[model samples]
Target: MRLLELTLPDAVENVALDEALLRQVEETDGQPVLRLWELESYAVIVGRANRIERNVNVEACRRDGVPIVRRFSGGGTVLLGPGALVFSLFLRVEKDRHLANIDAATAIVLDRVLTPLKGLVASLERKGTSDLASEGVKVSGNSQRWLRSTFLHHGTLLYDFDVSLIERYLSDPEREPDYRQGREHADFVRNLPISRDELRKSLTEAWDARLDPPELPFDLVRDLVRDRYRNDEWTFRM
Candidate 1:
């Protein structure tokens, strides 16, 4: 897999780029990609099917000038900022048989992630469906999106996040894994006990992914935002 380390200035553009990259992979039928990026600022990203009002504190977000946008994948809402590292994997469905089913797909990808995570922190386990937790507190959360020939498996690794921000801007998620056990965000989530470089290096080596440039239809990202992600009509359409 090829690796691309790129993040846009605008938070919505980063979300749109997630869809754009997956579509680009389908168009090229190229190598699987592992794109790692960090948001320069703060944003509240809602899952494709999530109810924004239920998952996010809209008044708090607006008061703090945080952009609330929706992505193309189904999962709970997430808060993205400089402290978080986002990894996006674009893979060909035919390349991996596990990609054909949703549960298996999530399993295989996260199982691969556990290799490096275990090395970084002890007693770390794959809890629930797509979360990496240590001693029952989540450090990473993931979600997926599929197309005809390719799919996207992306998630946030809380390498150095501020947990308080989540309490301020996000309401209690409507959907959660059983392991969460109705705990508040502050109690349920924690940052990984690893530096960004260490975590990035481990993931890159685990996947055998080499760093690459931004070669995949950059124009499509802007178009995606213009047509869908950046528009409040589409973002809040539910």
Candidate 2:
């Protein structure tokens, strides 16, 4: 497994970049990779087939100057921006009848994330399909896509993000039905006690523990981020 530590200094075209990089990794040696990134500002990302109007408050986002975008994968729409740490793992695997299923893919991704988070916080448990919770609150959420021989698992870690802004820009209060309308941003969302550098270092160490030393994963993934993901068509396409 090769680990790719790619960071977006400012949120360029994250969704597009993710899709492009996933495609490239699948074409190459297709070693498993771990990618970490942060957005430039807050934006809403919906599934490819989702009805933007039905799932999100587009006018509210536009009025608030929030970008509403679509991603290559499917999941409920999510509010993303600063204070969120995004991680993606792209791997090549033979589709086994058992674990190749989406639920198992999520389990693998969550396990990889929780292995380092243990002892730091209470042990993480699955909130739903891809969410990991501490106590009754949600901390991390993930989603995946299995294509050809590769799978892309991506998700967010709320580490000190602006909860109030997320509440304001998301428009659809119904989006978080699990939490109910009474949920307060500060109460429902949280930041990790650790700093960005600390989290990144710890994540890399964790991946190293389980896989072969990450080789060309870094450069290959970074190149794709710069050239392909930064494009406009990839960001706003319906």
Candidate 3:
């Protein structure tokens, strides 16, 4: 797999790039990739099909001047900021049965990615569909988007994020994973007590990720940002 460690200017471009990479691979038969990135500031990212008003605290977000955007995958809303580590896997769908089913794909991906951290934390287990938890507190949340022959699995790892900001910007989700147990944001999430470098190293080693930079389709990303991600009509269509 190819490795691309690039961070864009803001949430719109960051979210648009994920989909652009997926399209690039699907259209050009490009190699699979693993991307790692971090945001420069705070933002709220909702699931692709989520109802923003129902899932986010709009008043709080507007008051704080944090942009509310949507991603190209199905998952719960999340807060992203400086200390959050974001990883995206773009893989081709092959004969592997595990890569075809949502449940199986999530399990396989999380199991492989969390293996290196197993001994570092007290208990690292796959919780719900795509969440990784340590001692019952969620440390990571993941979601995916599938094309005809490829898919994009992207998620966030909270290394040193401000947990309180979640409650400030996002409301109680209309839906949640079973393991969440109806707990509030503050009680439900916790940061992994690990450095980004260590986590990135382990993931790269696990997938034999190469250090090659991706020739990203910047034009597509910009078009997506202008027409979809940054447009309120598309973002809040619900």
Q: In model 1, which regions exceed 4 Å deviation?
A: none
Flag regions of model 3 displaced more than 4 Å: 95-97
Model 2 worst lDDT window (10 residues): 209-218
Candidate 2 error regions (>4 Å): 8-12, 95-98, 173-187, 209-238
lDDT of 1 by residue, 1-238 (tens): 8999988888888888888888888988888999999998899999989998889999999998999999889888999998899999998999877678878888888888888778778788889988889999999889999899898999988888998899999999988899999999999999988899988998898789997754867699879888998788888987
Best by lDDT: 3
Over 64-165, each residue of candidate 3 has an lDDT whose tens digit, in order, gives: 899999888999899999889999999888846568777878888898898887857759899987899988899999999999988999988889899988
| Candidate 3 clash figure, as a count | 0
lDDT, model 3, position 26? 88
lDDT tens readout by residue for model 2, 95-197:
3344577887777767777887764775566776678777767777777877878888888887777777755655453345364336765566566666777
lDDT of 1 at 231: 86
By lDDT, rank the candidates, best first.
Answer: 3, 1, 2
List the pairs of residues colliding in candidate 2.
11-40, 160-191
Q: Each prediction's TM-score against the native?
A: 0.97, 0.78, 0.97
**TM-score winner, 1 or 2:** 1
Estimate the overall C-alpha local distance difference test score of candidate 3.
0.90
Supply candidate 2's per-residue lDDT for 146: 71
Task: Estimate candidate 1's alpha-carbon lDDT, on a 0 to 1 scale.
Answer: 0.89
